[model samples]
Structures are given as C-alpha cells and as structure tokens.
Target: MKLVPLTDRVVLKQCEAEETTKSGIILASAAQEKPQEALVIAVGPGGVVDGKEVTMQVKEGQKVIYSKYAGTEVKLEGEEYIIVRQNDILAVVE
Candidate 1:
C-alpha cells in the first residue's frame, strides 16, 4: 500500500546514519544516532489549517532537515517512514 499525506503533513524516509567514523572504526548500532536528514517521499496539498491558510514549502524528491524529535514513525511494505507536519521540517537541502 502507498502512503498519501493529507493536509500539511509530509512523508519522509530517513537517511541512514553513518556506520563508520572517519577514523575507519565501525560503530555499533547502539552508538549510532538517528539521522536528521531525510528524503521527501510525498507531500500534502496545502489547505486551510487551524483557521489559517497553510502552504507546503517542500516538494516530493527534495531532501530536508527536520527537528530531531519531530514526526511519527511508520512502517510500510517493510520500509520505515516518518509523517510530520511541514512546520516540523526545518529546511530544504539545496
């Protein structure tokens, strides 16, 4: 099944955290931190939210940086994804 975000929500796939350090030492999974970078998979259409008109600034295929603790995690077709409000997205990577 495919995911389609509604309202100002955005669907994202988390970028993998580095498995090794620059020194070439492999880090264990327990030592790895969640990546803040993500790839935009889908975006919701802009509409009125909370009595205010909202516009989506990010688009599908764009790389984005989001708040560390933002969004909800979901699993679809064995792949993980996060669904968050557009406002939670801090910036779009150029």
Candidate 2:
C-alpha cells in the first residue's frame, strides 16, 4: 500500500540507527535510539493560504532531520514510516 499525505505533509522512511560507536565499539540493544534522519518519500500538494497556495520547500529523496516526536507513525508496505508537516522538519541533511 502507498501513502499520500495531504496539505503540506510529507512521508519519510526512517533511517537505521547507528549500531556501533565511532571507536568501533558495539552498542547494546538498549542503547539504540530512533534515528532522527529520514529519507523523504512523498509530499503533499501546497497547503492553501489567504487566496494563495504555498508549496512545500522539501522534496522527495531529500534526507531530513526532524523532531524526535515530529510525526504520526504508521506501517506501509510492511515498513515503518512517518507523516509530518513541512514545519516539523528541523533541517535538510547534506
């Protein structure tokens, strides 16, 4: 199944969390945190404004950093994903 967000919302696939530390030290399972970065998969059409339509600045395939609790979680095509407003995005990963 496919998800299509509405009105300035975006869908993203959460990136995998780091499994090891910088020094090649393996981290325990309990030390894992949800990855803050994600790959944008889909975006909504521009949200309506005062007699105008403002499109989203983010685009598909862009990697972004978002709030830890930014979006609503859902399962699609047997994989986990999230949907959030463009405003929820903190920054675009280079």
Put down candidate 2 lDDT per residue, 19-85, tens digits, no spaces: 8788999876558877789999999997694576767999899999998877999897689889988
lDDT of 1 by residue, 1-94 (tens): 8899999999999987768789999887568787799999999997998888999999999999999989999999999999999999999889
List clash counts for every candidate, in order.
0, 0
Error of 1 at 85 (Å): 0.2
How well does candidate 2 score on lDDT at residue 39?
96
- Best model number under lDDT: 1
lDDT of 2 at 27: 75
TM-score of each: 0.89, 0.83
lDDT minimum window of 10 residues, candidate 2? 46-55
Error of 2 at 4 (Å): 1.2
